[model samples]
Target: MDRLIDAIERTQNPSVVGLDPTEALVPAQVVASFADEVRDSVDTPEEAPAAQLAVAFYEFNRTIIDAVAGIVPAVKPQIAMYEALGPAGIDVYTMTCEYAAEQGLYVLADVKRGDIGSTAAAYAHMLTGVNAGASAEAGSAGAGAHDPWHVDAVTVNPYLGTDGITPFVDAAKTADKDLFVLVRTSNPSSSELQMLDLADGSKVYEHVADLVERWGADTIGEHGYSRVGAVVGATHPQEGRALRERMPRTFFLVPGYGAQGGTAADVRGMFDANGSGAIVNSSRGIIGAWRTSGRYRKDMSADDALALVFDTAREAATAMRDDLRAVL
Candidate 1:
């Protein structure tokens, strides 16, 4: 949490760009260009489309990473996008995280997995890497040196309660990483469950907020936030502000900004008074800016298309930074 705060201070930006490249989001030319390169890499012809798209997604992600290296403190690569393509896509997700870290951007993996017992323990292993022929102790001991995920933090689900989350909290402390438990999400339907009334007459998310605050109570860092953070969607301005006070030691990873219709004003209260407790994320708004830029031509080469992606992403990122700064 302190490290992430330091990064925010260094960049003077609390925004994290989401590297969620989809088939429609990526330039068609770039995906087509990888046909020859990915065909031989796949086991069968049926897998070529996924393999080629995976390669294209990596390239597309790299361009965005390069574009916003200094402008933003972090990049949240949604794993679901990569997981869609199976193993090949997963490789790109890992590679994308590695590349983002190489460029000095904190990587927050969006893997909202939550389970109990051993299953929970195994999922928590994501905080630390597991190397071949190595014991679990030895694996986490390798830390970033042998870690394949290359992420500084990850997003987890809290649907299963304490047992499911405790393992991740312990692992984050041991690995010096962080985790954001889903509290109030930005999705439209999230309200159905998250906003339900508990037996105590409190909202479901409110109770979860209490748990999230409790989870990080002991690990308060120099920045005054704990390694255990909460994911409060930017769309819920009033709720986000209340959570800020309720979870004093808990940092926030806010999503649903930009393309999701979350404005700077909408998320302003999510941050602390001094603007230090939260990092807002924008996905399609940043990475897919090129699509709506109206400057693309189907005849452009792959490199040229990526160059457009870089320029547009950088411009969009700068605008987002300035937008958030204006409010902060």
Candidate 2:
């Protein structure tokens, strides 16, 4: 978490672009090349599509990563997007995570894994590069122990309470990683459960926030923020402000910043007086910039069109950075 904060402070940008690629959303040029490659391979035609599409997905992610690596402090890859393409897609996800790390960006895996303590421990190990059965001696190993697929942080689901979250907290401590527990999500239906009032007069998410604060207490970084952060949607600024007050030491992974009706002004409440403690995310808004902006014209050659796509992505990332900086 401290390392992540350092990167954020150095860049003076708290934005994290999401690398979520779908087959249908991939650029036609890239997909055509990948399909050609699949045709040349010896694998079955049916099996080849997934593998080839995975290549296209990786290409898209790599391009986006290259475009925004220097502008944003981090990139969050939603695992489900990669999972949808099957085993081959997972391979692309791994490649993207490693590539982002190599480009000097914090990679946050949005796994949202929740289960019993033991299963949660496995999830923690899988994301943080810790072996489930490693000895305490092996566990003490430094950052070098992390797996290539490991990320700097991961999002977890807290519905099961401490039983599901503690393993992640412990693993984060051991691996020097971070966890963003889902407190108030960005989806429209999140309120159906997260806003329920308890008999004690506290809301469900508030209690979860309290526990999240406690989980990262001992692991608070020099910036006075805990390794255990909260996922508070930018769409609900009032709830975000209240949660900021309640969890003063917890960093925030704010979603819904764009393409979800969450503007820069709406997310101001998630940050602190110093413009720290939160990293706003924009997924499709950034990745799909070329399609929406008309910068990549059909009249251009395929090579030139692809170049324009990268340029559009870079411009979009820059715009997002400027927007957040303005509000912060």
Best-performing candidate as measured by TM-score: 1
Give residue 178's lDDT in candidate 1 (0 to 100).
Answer: 94
List pairs with backbone clashes in candidate 2.
none
lDDT of 1 by residue, 1-328 (tens): 9889999999999999999889999999999999899878778899999999999999999999999999999999999999999999999999999999999999999999888845777777678776546444532233333677888888989988888888788878888899999999999999999999989999999999999999888899988899999999998999999999899999999999998789999999999889889999999998999989999899999999999999999999999999999999
Overall lDDT per candidate, in order of appearance: 0.90, 0.84
Clashes of 1: 0
Worst 10-residue stretch by lDDT in candidate 2?
A: 135-144
The digit string of per-residue lDDT tens for model 2 on 166-189 reads 888887887788999999999999
TM-score of each: 0.96, 0.93
lDDT of 2: 0.84
Distance (Å) between predicted and true CA of 59, model 2? 0.8
RMSD of 1: 1.7
Model 1 residue runs over 4 Å out of place are: 131-145
